[model samples]
Structure formats: C-alpha cells, structure tokens
Target chain A: MATTTTPAATPGRTKGTGKPAGPPGRRPRRSLLPYLLLAPAVVLELAIHVIPMLVGAWMSLLELTQFHIRDWSGAPFVGLDNYRVVLDVNSAAGAELLRSFRVTVIYTVLSVGLSWVLGTTAAVLLQRPFRGRAVLRALFLTPYALPVYTAVITWTFLFQRDTGLVNHVLVDQLNLLDDRPFWLIGDNSFVALLIVSIWRTWPFAFLCIMAGLQNIPDELYEAAAMDGAGFWRRLRAVTLPMLRPVNLVLLLVLFLWTFNDFNTPYVLFGGSAPAEADLISLHIYRSSFQTWDFGTGSAMSVALLLFLLLVTAGYLLLTNRRRNDA
Target chain B: MRETATERWTRRIVLTLLAGFVLVPLYVMVSSAIKPLQDVQAAFTWWPRRPTLQAFVDMWSTVPLGRYLINSLLVASVAAIFSVAVAIFAAYAVSRYRFRGRQVFSVTVLSTQMFPGILFLLPLFLIYVNLGNATGIALYASRTGLIITYLTFSLPFSIWMLVGYFDSIPRGLDEAAQVDGAGPLRTLFQVVLPAAVPGVVAVTVYAFMTAWGEVLFASVLTNENSRTLAVGLQGYSTQFNVYWNQVMAASLVVSVPVVAGFLALQRYFVAGLTAGAVK
Candidate 1:
C-alpha cells in the first residue's frame, strides 16, 4: 500500500489502523485544516448551547426578577438565593417545585417503561417476517413520524371531557365508568399526558429495537431450540443477551427524552398545567416566563441539568463496566 | 421451517389490534378535521359523515395559515441546511482524522443531547436582549434568531448521525482520492459525501423535522411576524373558545409536510437512527 501522509493528520494516529489513503491535493500548510473545518460547528455550539448553559448558571445566581428582565445585567446578584428558594421545603413555592419534580420523575418512569415494553413487544413480534409486515411496521412508526405538536394536539381533543373519543369509548361504549371522567383536568391529567407521551415515543423504541433484533443471528435461536428451550427461554438466553447493547442505549435515550420533554405536556395541558400533572419542565417555564422569575427558573433548570448529568454518567459507567465484564 | 396456522392467526390478530391502537388517534385527527363542528361534537363517529373543507377554510380565514406555513417551511429548511452544512465539516474531521480530543469531542456532542433545551432558553434570551441592545441585530424576535436556535439544538444530533454515517463509508475511497491527488476537502465532497447520501438525507430530514415541529422555543422566541406553524397552532388553544374543527384541521395541515418527509425519506432516516445508536 502506498502511504500518502496527510499534512495535518495527527502525528501518532495514522498508524496500524489500516486506514485508506488520504485525499489528494493538500494545501502546502494543512496543519490548520482540521481546526478550520471544525471552527464553525464549535463556535455555534459554544455560542448557542455551551456558553449559554454556563451563563444560565451565572444568571441563576443573580435575582433576575420580572422587572430586571429587560436589563438583566442590572439584576441583583444574590448568590445561591434562587437555589435556596427552590430547595426550601418549608416554603410553598419550594414545596410545589418539589411536587412537580416528583411528578416529573413518575412521568418519566411510566412513560419510558411503557414505551419500552410496548416497543419491545412490537419489535419482537414483527421480527418474524410475515405478509404485510412492511405495512404494519410503517403503521406502528406513524406516531413517531408525525409532528409532536400535531400528535399531542390531537390527543388533547381526544381527551376532552365532554366530546373526547377516549371517554366516549371508555365510558359510553365499554361502560367502564359511570361518568365521563375529567381526563384533561384533575389527577387524570397525568394519565392523559402519559398516554400522549407513550404514543409519541414507543414507535422510536420499536424502530431501534427492530434494528437491533435484525442484527442477532438466527443460529442462536435455532441452537436454543435444539436444546429444548421454549420461546421465552430462547428469548431470555439468546435475544435479550444479544440485545443488551441496543437496549442500554435505547433505554438511556428514552429516559433522557422523556425526562427533558417539554413539548408534549406543554401542548396537551396549555400554559398552566394542572397542579396534579404539572411537570418540572412546564413548572420551570411558568416560573421564568409566566411568572417572570428567571433566577428561580434558572436554578430549577440547573438542578435538573445536574440530576440528568449524574444519571447519564452513572448509566454510562454501569454500561461500560458491564461491557468490560462481558 | 413450516409455519403453523395457529401461530400465523395469532400474529395477525395481535398485529391488527396493535395497528388499530396505533392508528386510532391519527384516524380521529383526520376524521375530526374534515367534519363540521356539529359532527365533531355530536357523537363518536369514527369517520366524518358530512365531510367538508369548511374547517380548513375557517382555519385559514381566522389565522394567517399560509404565512405560518411559509415561515415554518423557511425556518426548518434554512435550519436544516445550515445545521447539516456545519455538521459535515465536524463529522468529516472526526471520521477521517484521529486527532487530539477526538473522543472528547464526540463525547461532548453526545452529552449535549442530555442538556435540555430549556437550560439554554433563559440565558440565551438574556444574551439576545443584551446583544440586541448593544448592537441592534434583532436577535430575539426574528426568524434568523429562531433558525440559529434550531441550529444549536439540531447540530449535535446531526453531527452524531453524520459521524456514524461517515464511519460506515470505507477508508479506501479516501485512499483512492489521495492517489488521484485530491485533497481532504475534495475527497469528502466528491467521494465520501456522495457515498453517504442516505446519511445526508437522514440528517437533513432529522433537522428539518425537528425545527418544523419545535414549540417551546418558537412560542417564547418568535414574534407574530415570524411565528411558525407550531406557535400559530397554539393560538387555537389559547383562545377562550377553541374551535375544535379548526384546531384539528390546522393540526393536519401542520403535520402534512413532516409526515410526507418522513415517508419519503424513511429508509435513510431509519438507517441514520439505527446507525447512530446501535453502532
């Protein structure tokens, strides 16, 4: 193999990987090429996402109350006061924030768990090829493909207490309830939000798990079958073990999405989410925009970010350890 | 192996029921959108009996539906193009060169996904206000501003998807390009990118679809002149009296492009998704 050295290629990287040839025609000085190529993306990410995140942490320290919002620099610097406000369990607002956080945790668990169960069941069922399977796959994925606002908006109408199809079927058709339960209000609002969340997300799980399922070798199943293993046994022994990597990634992603989700609940519940179904995301949004308390909102958000980062890091460490053990 | 009749029947029955569960809300959406107000609230009819375009017409008359669509399309399209363009360079560098901080860079990109968009909103809002005050660039209430925000949210995922895609393209192509005297940039454009067409389409669709449907930022960031379809649709609900037919109709209208795009580019989309995660 004729090895053509890349002018700006890393000193130690171009060895032993059996990589292909470098592209032709290098500028005489190519040491800066990679940086040049990467600059725009790096700048944008830092400016928009990274820097703003740090700035949010700083703003969380300042008392960016409603009046000072126009001129945020003039906002009083009250170090950790906003965080104290959120964490102060004795205070009503603090208690409410804690309650919303609990609701968010429950929401995330139910939403992720149900979506994963449904998605996995569907993926495994559809793994065995059959006629019209392609159409069925497409049908299953339709919810995920549709716009979030549109899908959730439809769910809002569907969950309306008076005219909703959900109550019509559950109450009128099935006689499951004595009355049309208030789905879009009261404690049932959580159920309503969960239904919309699960509907929108499961299809993604299905798609990912299906892709994972395709990678498993049929021989493993056949071998298990020959050993007198039943379907469940075969799945446990062959499919589940084989799919651990995909499942870990899928579950983590699903958790992250469900935890951070703002759109579904926002659209479903409108601005002021029912106290029972008030998710932390909506709660934070209300704190900042609706109530014009940016400092407290930023503090809650910072708390949320730190919690998520811890979970993510822990998840990664657990998965990496498992991989090494395997 | 021969299939058993019982097994086949069971699979069919289960699939059909699941499909119904999946399709019912979509059915309700379409069925309610075309139905008149009387039909919508009258009873639980699965299909519209007296289907009319009146709801669509009413929605258009009441709201700037056309302008909302145009604005959304413009924002989504530009956001997708810019995000994908910037992502290509980063993805290419990561895929082709094993430089210092490469792993850190890739990990950072993945970590960005963990930070919720709301985390950026307040500070970005403040920055926008401050920057606009200092230098009159109108970053808060403009389509350009909204697009930039979308780009921020979309870039990490796009770059992640593209990196996976570029990794899949054989290193031999670059080798061949080098032999032919093409530079890294040319090889990426001429050899690697064309070969990774599915990834490009997937990234484009992903970014476009995200920007198209994004609501939280759009609701807070854009003004009436620059309001997107998502924000515009919210108007129907915020009013004292929500017109169910109009909301349904408007929801359908907003969904058409995203659904159509997903269907048209599904293969690439699936490939991108699966590749990004599973690998």
Candidate 2:
C-alpha cells in the first residue's frame, strides 16, 4: 500500500523535477525582483506605448483634447460615438479617418514587402565576405543611417522635375522623358514616396537578415557541402530555416514601422497637399496638430492603435506556433 | 582546395557590378555636396567640375549643424549608457531565471518593437506638455527627453541581444562559482561580465547608431532647442527654397558614424549578428 501510494506521487514529482524548484514561497515575489530591475524600462515603454494606447482607447470613448491649456477635463461619456464619427462618411471626421486607414495600409504593405525582398537579396549577396566586401557592406548602410530629413530632401532634389539628377538622366541623358516628368506632383506623388520608401527601408531587412545569416552554422554548410549540396540548395535547406525567427521579427518590425512611418513620406511629400502620398501619421498630424480637432485625432489614434494591436497579435500567434513546430 | 575559374569570374563580375550600383547615388551625393549649386543644377556630372566645399560651408553657417551634432552625440551616448545598463540586469534575469513571467516579459519586449511610434506619439506629446506646464521644466524639447525616448525603444533590442549572449555563456562557470559559495550577483559580475564585453560593446554601438540616426520622434518631440542632426537637416528646406547641395552634405555628415562603426567593428558586428539569434 505504501509503495503504491509513493508510486502514485511519482508522476507529479517527475514532471516537477524536469524544471528546477525556484525560490520557495517566493515564486511570484521572486519573479518581481527581476521586474524591479525591469521597472524603469517598463515605466518608459508604458509611458510611450501602453499608457498612450489606453489613453487613446479612453479618448475614443470621450471627447479628449489638450487644445486649450486650462480645463483638460473628460467630457461625459459618448460610447463608440467617436468611432461612429470616424467610420461614417457623411461625417467629415469619418471620411478623413477612412482616408488615413487606406493610406496607412498601402504604405505599410508596400514598404514592408519591397524592403524585405531587397534586404534579403542584399543579405544573401553579403553571406560571404571577399575583397572589398567590408567596404561594400559599409557603403550599403548609408541609406539607413543617413538622416531621414536629408535622404528625403535628397529624394526631393532627385525627383524635382527640372534641374534634378533623375530628370537630367531621364529626360536629358537617356531621353526616357521627353519633358521632365513631374515626379512629385499628382500622379507621381506616391511613386516618389515609394522611391524614398524603398531607399530608406531596404536596409532594415539587410540588418535583420545579416544578423540571421550569422546565426547559421558553417558546420551545417560544410556537412551539406560534404554531401555535395549546391549553393541554392544549401540556402533553401539550412539558411532559410535558421533565418525564420529574425525574418518574422523583421516582418513585424517593418510592418509596424512602415505603418507608422511619418518622417520620410512627410518630408518627401509634405503633410499638406499630396493626399495621394500622405500616410496616417501625416493625416493625424494634419488633424490634431494642424487642424486641432483633438477628439477626432485621438479617435484616429485609437483606431490606428487597434489596427497595430491586431497585426502584432497575429504576428505573435504565427511566430509562437512556428517555434512550437521547431 | 580552391574556387574554380568560373566561380572567381562570376564572383568578381557580380560583386563589381553591384558595387557600381551602390556607389552611384552615394557618389552623386558626395559630388553634389561639394559642387557649387549651379553645377549641381546643371547636367548630370559624375565628377563635380571645379569642386568646392561651398555647400559644406553653407550647410554649417545656414543651420545649427554644430549644435545638432553636439545634441546627437550627447543624446546618443546617454541613451547608449542607459540602454546597456538597464539591459544587462534585465537580460541576466531573462537568461538565467526561468520564472513564471519569463516568457511574458520577453514577448512584451519583442512586441514593444512592433508597436508603432504613432500609437504613443499623441498621448506622450500631451504628457510632455503637461510636464512642462506643471513643473515649469520640460523633457519634451530638452536633450533629456530625447535620451529617454531613445532608450525606451532601444533597450528592448539591446536586452534581447544581451539575453541571447547571456544564454551562450556557459552555466558551468556559474555552477562552479556557486559550488565555491559565490552569490548570483557575484557570479554575474566576475564570470558573465568579462565574457559579455564584446556583446555589450556591440549593443552600445547599436544604441548610439540608433539614437544618432533617429529622426521622427526627434522632429515631433523636439522642435526648438534640442534639434538632432537629422532635424537640423530639415532646415535646408525653407518656405520658398530647398538647399539641395547643403542637404546632401548633411546626409553625408549623418552617415559617417554608421559607416565608420561597421568598418571598425566589421568582424564583431558580423559575428554578433548571428550570436544570440539561434537556439
């Protein structure tokens, strides 16, 4: 009976023994110690990310503003009314909000996709370091580290219809354009933004994938080569598998960044006018900071926050499942 | 024992051609930055004929380039220090202890990177305004605010990287230390700290590069005194005219460190890139 009773206890003990016993009676509290170390970072990130999200959510429920400095009190609750105003077209705010979302998605998807392909290709090219490889790698990072205002301004100069390098090439040199195409005007507005977009962003993928490439073991390649694997075959089998985590991380990062991207687009295509190129960040700037419609701008922020939350949640779910498989 | 002629030729041709493609815009930028404005405006010239440093001269006197550079250096350094310091402890925790919230904490940090800055911009803007209003002292337009914000975004990556570095550190060292009666902190300081120097350096360099290069928050958050080199570049475009030569010069100015850092630590950066990545 005693042996059987002890044997019954073994299952729980065995499973528990697989993991170490953390500080007794201090499991929750012991964990809090690390968190205490983590407190400053948490507090800053909260102030930056979480609290604003909550506030935006809260603001969506109320008429929130910092327009006139004095009062700053919350108006009586109007549940989902801001969201209604945002989504409904008859309402001006709704039309603007809809515009913002449309532009935001376009910016996000294109920025993420184009940059990913370019960066990945660059990383692949860079997997081996030969002569001048070091210099070339350094050279490639220029687009990334160059100040946005400068790069955009440079883009602005390049895309300027007349007396621009691009126009000089397209019209005068190659004769691609009979007359200089107005690259920053109506039709070419977003196209100009896209050039700046690709130029500025492709480096992100380069950084992420470069990091990913480093993680792949030379031994794996050697073994595969010993088995007579080709370069493409090796990349497909070994490199891609190793790069999965960084790729996912980069995807999420690029998506979020492109979605929120303000500076490059804004500088290239100014906040006012250029509606074709204006992203949500620019739109929000127009509404809140420019138009001073605090309630609606806050609503737009809330909506944007929700969209980001969904994307991030989806990314997490996918990556988590992927890790589970591995 | 060696590559075939085909391999050598193919590598040479591909690499040389790609280098040309990469160098074109960069060459244009450098050429333009040194050229007189009229020369830049004229036909495409690979080499700026009669190259002068007039644009660089103009770039300095026209804007707060010196101040912005100082601001960038200061903010980047402070953010780097704060990021690395905070990261070391947090990274140690996440790596060493498999606590209940370990997974949650890591996920939170990773997810923080994916959260758009726009989501935080408005509320944080108000928060800063209020801080200014309340204390009669402000962080928003001050150098301090820039450092704070940079660290917030930067810490997560640094921490994430450091944690991966920490995991690679042999736990046997800790085991031996524990057997010899050294405490956890002692083990970390004596064993892990020395080993983690290279990674810590990489993280610091990364943090500096990020803070130095960042523009968005720098623009919105600090408009007046705390202008970054990036924000200062925007000054080239005024109400009526854009200073193309000067702007290109400024862009060249900003890219120096990232290029230099990569060159200086090319070996380490490549190595660290793969480090802390794989399980």
Candidate 3:
C-alpha cells in the first residue's frame, strides 16, 4: 500500500540501462532543476493548504465573528471556548452539532454502504460481455460524469413535492404512499439527500469495481467453477477475494468523500439544509457564514478535520494489518 | 462457467433496474427542459405535454447566466491549465528524482486530500480578507482569490495521478534523452509529455470538472459579479418561485461539456484514477 500510494518512494528502475552509477557530484547542475520545478507546487500547496490550515487552527482560538471579521487579529482570544460550546451536548450549539454529527454519520454510512453495494452488484453483473453492455456501462457512468451542481440541482427539481417525478412514481403510479411528501424540506429531506447521494456516488463505485474486475483473471473463475462452485459461491470465493485491495481503497475513498460531502446537501436543500438532513459540512457553513460565528465554525471545522484524520489513519492501519494477516 | 437461463434473466433484470435508476434524473432533466413552464410547475408528466425551447432561451436572460458561464470557464480553465502545468513539473520531479524531502512532499500533498474543504473555508476566507487589507491585494469576493484557492483542490490528486502516469513511461526514455545531451526539462517536454498526454488530459478534465462543480468555496468566496455557475445558478429560484424548466435547460447546457469530455476520455480517466488503488 505504501509503495503504491507513494510513487516517489519507489526507486526508479531504468530499463535496459547497464551503465554504472555516475559519481556522486557529477550532476550538480541538474540537481537544482527538480527543486526549481517543484517550487511552484510547494509554494501553492503552502499558501492554499498549509498556511490556511494553520490560520484556521489559530482562528479557532479567537472569538472571531462578524464584528471582529474586518480585523480578525484584533478578536479577543477565547481558547477552547468555541470547542467547549460546540462539544458540550447540553448546550444548544453543541446539541445541534451533535445532531448534525449523528445525521452525517448515518448519511455517510448508508450512502457509502448502498453505493458500494450497488456499484459491486452492477459491476459483477456486467462483468461478462453481453449485448448492449457498452451502452449500459456508459449510461451507468453518466451521473458521475455530470457536474455535481448540475446533477444535484436536477435532483432538487425531481424531489420537488408537487411536481416531482419521485413522488409521482411513488404515489400516482406505484401507489406506494398516499401522501406526496415534501422532499426538499422537513424530515424527508434526509431521505431525499441520501437518494441523490447514492445516485451520484454509486457510479464511481461501479467504475472502480469494474476496473478492479478486469484485473481478476478468468482462470480464477474457471478454477472456482472446476471445483463445482456455483455463481454465488464463485463470486464469494473468487470475485470478492480478488477485489479486496480495490475494495479497501475504494471503501475508504467513498467513506471520506461521502462523509465530507458538502455539495449534494447544500445544492439539494439549498444553502441552509433542514435540521433533519443537516450534514456537518453544511452545519459548519451555516455556523460561520450564516450566523457569522467564525470562531465556533472554525472550531467545528478543526474538529471535523481531526475526526477525519483519525478515521483515515485508523482505516489505513486496520487495512494494512488485515493485509498482513492475510 | 456458463450461466444458466435463470442467471441470464437475473443479470438482465438487475441491469435494467440499475440502468433505469441511472437514467431517470437525466431523462427528467432533458424532458423537463422542453416542457412549458406551467407544465413543469404542475403535476409531473412522464413526457412533456407542451414541448418548447423557451426555457433554453430564457435561461441566459433569467440570471447573468452568460457572465456566470464566462466566470466558470475562465476560473476552471485557468485553474486546470495552471494545475496541470505545475503538476507536470512536480510530478516529473517526484517520478524521476529521489531528492531530499520527496517523500514528505508526496505525503503532504496526498494527505491534503483527506481534509475537508470546510476546514479551510473559514480560515481561508479570513486570510483572504486580512491579506487583502494588509497587502492591498483583494482575494475576498474576487475571481483571482477563487482561482488561487481552487488550485490545491485538484493539485494533490493531479500530482499523485501524474506521478503514477509518469512512472509508467520507462526511465530508459529519460536516460536516453539525457545521454544525448537533452536536459531534464527538454526531456520532460519533448519526450515524456508526449507519452503522458492521456494522463494530462485526464488530470485536466478532473481539475476542470472539480472547479466547475465546486460549491462550498464559490459560495463564500464569490459575490454576484464574480459568482461562478455553481453559486449563480441558484438565482433561478428567488424568494417567489423557481424556474424549474429553465434550471433544467441550463443544467443540460452546463453539463454537456463535462459529461461529453468525461465520456470521451473515460478509458484514460479510469486507468489513471484506479492506478493507485488497484496497483
């Protein structure tokens, strides 16, 4: 995993080059070029990611609000106060944050789970060549290909109560429900958000899993079949095991992307998501931008970042350990 | 391992179901765009009753769609081009050279992908404001600011993927070029780049699509004049009503370039994206 993830860490292998290594100081002039080439990316990464992260951590300690925004440095220091307010479950802000956190957890889990399942299902089913398979594969990837805003905005329209196709199918056609529930607002907004999220993300899972499927040689399946392993048994023994590495990375990527997703909820529900469907990203956005409480917002943002870092670290560690065990 | 009739039917059924799920929103968008405003505002219809292209015409005038489009194009294009250029150099260095801090650089860039954009939003906003005040260069509510902010969003992935892509091009090529007195820069541009064009295109499309679809930053960063389509498209729905037809029309228009580009380069994009995970 480390070797694959870090391309630079792997020593370059020169093909057909029998030449011995040059003297250590032979290429002094060329040494500077790498640094020169790297300077722009390094500088931009610092400005865009590193510096702002440090500043964000700093801002988390200050009572930065609309009042102090113009001259944020002058904002009074309030170390841990923002964190306390947001993390204390008894407090309104904290309670709301907790609710949003729970919602996000549920949303991420369900979205990731459903997307992976759908993606794997579609990929496995379409693994073998069939009629119109090319068209179907291309069609399946359309959602992922479409811009996030365009796709979600279209969803917002589809989720509309009075004129929505979702309700029309469920109520008018399928007779699954008597009432045409308000999808973009109230409690159902969460469900609406989840649907759009699954719709948007499942295609990516499909693509990744499909690519992974190609790497699994047919001999594995043929061997499984020689052992009298049926379709379900063959899939379990051959397909899933071979796809483990891809799944490990795919699941983690999906988890991170879906967990931190802001676009789908923000666009589907507009800027201010309903409490029932408030993701932490939008919650933090509303905390700072809407309420002008940059301090608390930054605190929440820092917390979210820390939580994600922990999850990613834990995920990588666990996967690496499991791989070692295998 | 030949599938039985039952298995064949099951595959077809599942595929059809999944395809419907995938196509419904797209079908709705295309069908709704042609519907009359009243028809779209009323009960949903499987097909448009009164088909018209009025929404397509009205979309441009409804908001400053043209201005927003231009802003999106400029921001996304410049960001993509700059990101690709910077990434090519950095990727080359990382791929070909094992200098000090290379691992740290690669890891730092890769780890940035794990951080949420919201984490940067508040502080970046403040930095822009404070920097603007102190340095007399406006970053808040400015296109320049947005572009600068958006650079890192795709930089890490671009670098990571390009490194993988560049790693595939044999070192023999670079060694041969170097032996012939071609410098690293000349080898990269003339030798490696031509071979890595597909990877560059994939990265460009990814970066462009990212910038195009970005909502969180553009929401906070850009004002009306500088608003990209991601934020500006919300104008279609004011306090009074939502122009659903026109919104759909505009969505189709906005999505065409990206969707088409993505599908066209689907093979390379998939290969580049999955290289890290699969390998």
Candidate 4:
C-alpha cells in the first residue's frame, strides 16, 4: 500500500522541480537503494539457510562421513542409497527413525494440546481483573522468559532419581508411588520431556492468547449474556470463534516449534536421549554427530524438512479454506 | 460477568495450582543454587540443611565458567546487534518501498522460519569447514563462525516482526522528512527509527535471547576455546560425579539478564510478536 502511493508522489513532486524528468536522475538510485538495504539479510540468509539447505540436499546423495568431512568433494555420490537405508523399515536405522518419528508426533500433539488448553484457561480466567493478577501473569511467564538451557537444566536437577524434587514430592512426601522413578531415562523420559516441554511452551501460548483476548470486544460477551447464555455458551460461541485467527497461527507455530524442538530434549537428556524420548531433531543429531554418518544424517534432515513443509502447507490451506467457508 | 462463590473458589484453586507448577522448578533452582554440594547430590530436600553461597563461589573454579560466560555474552550480543541493524534496513525496505521480487523475498525469509534447524546444521557445519580449508580461516571452532550461524536464528524473525512494526508507524513522518530534503537513510535513522524504539528493543532482546539459549548449533560448532555457556556448563558433570549445586548456581547467573530483560520489556515484545497475527 505504501508502495503504490509513494512512487506516484515521488514522480509528481520531482516533475514540479522543473528538471528534465524523463526518468529522473534519482530514479535508478532510489530503485537500487531497496536492494542495497536488503543485501545483508539476503546474503546472510543465503549463507546461513538457503545455501546450507541446498548443500544438505546435495550431501544426502553423497557418501559423506567424518572420514570425508574435510574433503567432502572426494566423497562418492551415492544415488538414493542413503534414503534407501534410512527409509527401509527392515533396517535398524529405518526402524529407529520410524520409532523416533512416532514419539515426536505423539509428543508434539500432547505438548501443543495441553499447552494451548492451559494457556487459554489462564488467559480467559485472567481476562477480567482480579487481585494479584499482574503478579500471577508475570509469574506464569517466568518459565518462558528464562533461558531454555537454564529451565531444562533446572528440570534435570529436579528430575534426578535420587535427589530430584519430583520424586521427593511424588514418592517421599505424597507417597503416591512405591518406587522413585527415573525421569531423564527409560520409559518415563517421554513423560519428563513432555512435562518440561509443556512447562516451557504454555506460557507462550498464554501470552499469545492473552494478547488475542485484548482484541475481542467486551460487547460480544455482553450480547451473549443478554441472549440468556451461560458462561460456557458464551465461551463456546463468542470466545472461541473470535480467537480463531490467533489460534490458527499460534497452533501452527506451536506445532512446528514443538515438533522440531532440539533444546528441551538435548539439555534434558544431554545430547543422547533415550529411545522413549528421542525427538527427531536429536535423533538426527545423534545420527550425524554420533555415528559420523553425515550423508544419512543429511538425508534424514532433508526428509524431516520436507515433512514439515508439507504439514505447514496443508495447515495453511486448510485454515484458509475454513476461514473462507466461515 | 460476576462470579458466584463456588466459581471464585475454583478460580483461586486453579490459579494456585498453575502458579505452583510454574514456580516449583524456579524455587528448586534458587534453593539448589545455595545448598551445599553434598546436600544436593545426597538427597532431595524441600529445605536446605545449610544454605550458603559457597556453590556460587565454587562454580567459577569448577570449570571455565568465567570464560564461558564471556564467550556467550560476546557471541550473543554481537549477533543480536548485527541482526537488528541488518533487519532495520531490510524491514524499512519491505515496509516502505515497492520493489521487484519483494513478495518473494518476504515469503522466503518467513518460510525459512519453518524449516528445522537440523536441516541447515550439517551443511552449515560442512560449509564452515570447507570455507575454512579454502581460505585458511578457522570457522569450524571459531567465535566468528558461531556468530554467523547465529544470525540465521534471529534475522528472519527480526525482519518479519520489524516489518510488521514499521508498517504500523505512519508513512507521513518519513515523507515529511523527505520533503525537508532528508535522504532515505537519514529519514529512517533520524525520523522513523526514533518512533520505533520500542520495536527495535523488542527485536534486539528477542535476537539476544535466541542466541543466548541456543544449544543445537553451540553444541557442534564450538570447541574448547570458543565454547559457550550452553555447552560449557555441561562440563560440571564429569564421568564420576555431577556438581549439581554449582550447575544450578551458574544457570541462575546466566539466566538473570535474559529473564529480567524479557519481563521488563514484555509488553513491547508481545505487541511486536502478535502485531502481524492479531491484527
């Protein structure tokens, strides 16, 4: 919008200056300035993201390994063999990858679902002012504001088998369980990862939902009340519908971030996560870094990227269509 | 709407429960940071037997905590400054001008946010190595390499959010500066940027925090000399024992600046983040 009006004004104002204005001397310079301004971002993005991605795709087809890392050009180009090895269900790598994928999917769903619910509940409850609301709001956002490593490291300390407060509460104080459970390892690792993920993420959801609620008119709730609607009915009709746009973007972002989360698992489990909680990001990290198989790791990374891209595209399309239908 | 006594009780109970959930780990971090090392490693206690700041004092000697802190500070700050400076110009361009390929540029930058960091990690690592080999400059385990890698993390969101922020600023102010014979750069820096201080602060803090907490790249990219706190802190736990108390102490020290900065500027940061979506 600024573009349409500004360019027209520029030419007209320059014409009134009485210069020979068949493409003013400043026109080319002006046109080039935007590109000049954009140059740093473009170059950084290319060097950091775009070129790396293209190179990753290329590396997926090569037999790149630690042995060949210094001189990757010498690594033989293996046509689709890395993909075949990683995708074959019968193979160990493929089986592990599939299992990791399943774990990640379930983890993402639960983390995103629970986080959204908690955030929305807190936001709606806090929407109308009450005593100590500001303190509670700030307190709730503390986890999100804290560094991920610090928060997860704290969680790790709390989840320690012998000395963790979680077990101390559940086993020692509350006497809920007969045995002290290990949180950062084995079957319980999934639950631990999920709890930390939800804890770290829900505050973000609350922030977004709270921001979204500010835009919703109080008149809607009043109208619903006048229609003899109860709180639940008002929430269902007025609150949820009005929060759709926020929910759409928030949910998608949460889904992607949660799915691709490397920090929570990495810090909580310390690089090598248990099979139960091996998020795909960390799994790929181990595959590449641990096994020193850059080619297969790059293949898995490319595959994961494609899957995420597909999900994002589909999510946008579905959400856009729903908005149109509504 | 007015709430009944029953509803009020439920709200209070839920609020307390959620607050406890949020505060417990933080409580643990603070409590553990002061507890004696043996008290932390031996048993989990709600109250510290002998609470002391000895762990805080010991944390520095236990590892290269000071070096890690300095490295993290330097890397995160430099990356944040560069990302913000670059984003300001790019955001201004996208916000104020019509250019060929502007839409493609915007979309590409935004879409980069969706791709997982792992997708770029391996290749970026390789590129650093290869480029180092070719040019005789060490990027594989260098601070400059880490800073470059970190730009990708913050630059996209910085540009996107700043674009939204700049769009909200009225174009007339810049136009008035233009009519006053101020060039575009001058109009941007002297005229437009003054009004967008809050937005700039928000972006800078976001970028700094992102670089500060990042683990994935920091893990692989940095070695001993250039190790950041994110990876360096893990050194406290050796094969034989874990210095839990010292780790907690160090975590708190590193977390203070970021958490305080975020909470202080929470309003502006939230406004900048949700501006594009909520509108």
lDDT of 3: 0.88
TM-score of chain B of each: 0.94, 0.91, 0.97, 0.97
Looking at candidate 1, what is the lDDT of residue B49?
A: 86
In candidate 3, stretches whose alpha carbon ends up further than 4 angstroms from where it belongs are A1-30
lDDT per residue (tens digit) for residues A1-326 in model 3: 11111222223433122333343223544466679889999999999888889988998999988898888768999999999999999999999999999999999999999999999999999898988998998899999989899999999999888999999999999999998889988889999999999999999999999888888889999988999999899889999998998898889889989989999989998888999999999888887877798999999999998898899899889989988998
lDDT of each: 0.84, 0.73, 0.88, 0.89
Ordered by lDDT, highest first, the candidates read: 4, 3, 1, 2
Judged by DockQ cut-offs, the docking class of candidate 4 is medium
**Candidate closest to the true structure, highest DockQ:** 4
Looking at candidate 4, what is the lDDT of residue A111? 100
lDDT of 2 by residue, B1-279 (tens): 244677667667765765565566677777789988787666656677888888888888888888888888899899989988888888887888767777888888777776666656766777777788889768778888888888877888888888878888888766654444444565677778788888888888878877886766787788657888867777877887767788888778777666677456655555565675564
lDDT of 2 by residue, A130-203 (tens): 77776777766667766566667777777777667778777788887677788887868877787678878887
Q: How many backbone clashes does candidate 3 have?
A: 0
Q: Is candidate 1 or candidate 3 better by lDDT?
A: 3
Which stretches of candidate 4 lie above 4 Å from their native place? A1-30
Residue B44, candidate 4: C-alpha displacement in angstroms: 1.1
Model 3, position A271, has a per-residue lDDT of 84
**DockQ result, candidate 3:** 0.53
lDDT of 3 by residue, B43-126 (tens): 999989889999999999989999999999999999889999999999999988879989999989988887888988888888
> Candidate 4 chain A, which ten residues in sequence have the lowest lDDT sum?
A1-10
Query: Which rank order by TM-score, best down to worst?
Result: 4, 3, 1, 2
* Candidate 2: true contacts recovered, fraction: 0.42
Interface RMSD of each: 6.1, 9.9, 7.6, 5.3
Query: What are the per-residue Cα lDDT tens digits for candidate 1 across B21-71?
Result: 898898888888899878776656776888998998899867888889999
> Which is better, 2 or 4, measured by DockQ?
4
